[model samples]
Target: MPVIRVEMFKGRTVDQKRQLVKELTDAFIRTCGGTPESVQIVITDVAKEDWGGAGILMSDKYPDKK
Candidate 1:
């Protein structure tokens, strides 16, 4: 089994996530020769306040976004 973890700011729609997982599974199967059913994908959605970059909170860094 192959496990894939993706962490990103929370705002993506269900369709986007579905497409991402499908494409990821396809790529893994093509490169690693694994069944799509055996591939595990975990997506972690974090709020801008919970994530930090460049020593600053993302929410504070980009106040224009929600």
Candidate 2:
């Protein structure tokens, strides 16, 4: 089985996330020749504050902060 983990800044619309998962899963299936049941898609959405970059919180750089 293949387990894929995708991490990104939170606040994406549900549609976007779903599409991303679907596309990625499809890619894996195509390359690795696996069935949907054999491939696992895991998405971990992190708050900008939880992710730091270049000595600054990602939230500070992105307008996604709330």
Candidate 3:
């Protein structure tokens, strides 16, 4: 079995997440010859506020200034 974890900032559509999971699973199946049932995909969507750099949240780290 192969486990693939994807971590990224939040705000993606359901379709986008679905595509990502499908493609990742497909890759594992193609290269590792693993079945979809044997492949585990975990997607973690971290909020921008949970990420920080230099005392600023990623939500605050730009000109848009969320």
Q: What lDDT score belongs to each candidate, Candidate 1 first?
A: 0.93, 0.86, 0.85
What is the Å distance of residue 5 in model 2 from its true position? 0.3
Among all candidates shown, the one with the greatest lDDT = 1
lDDT of 1 at 30: 95
By TM-score: ranked, best first = 1, 2, 3
What stretches of model 1 exceed 4 Å from their correct place?
Answer: none
lDDT of 1 at 6: 100
> In candidate 1, what residue range of length 10 has the lowest lDDT sum?
57-66
lDDT pick, better of 2 and 3: 2
What is the clash count of model 2?
A: 0
Residue pairs whose backbone atoms clash in candidate 1: none
What is the TM-score (0 to 1) of candidate 3?
0.77
lDDT by residue for model 3 (1-66), tens: 778889888889999999999999888888889579998988999988788888788877753444
lDDT of 1 by residue, 9-48 (tens): 8989999999999999999999989799999999999999
Q: Which candidate comes out best when scored by TM-score?
A: 1
Model 1 TM-score on a 0 to 1 scale: 0.91
As for candidate 2, its clashing pairs are none
Count backbone overlaps in model 3: 0
For each candidate, what TM-score against the reference?
Answer: 0.91, 0.84, 0.77
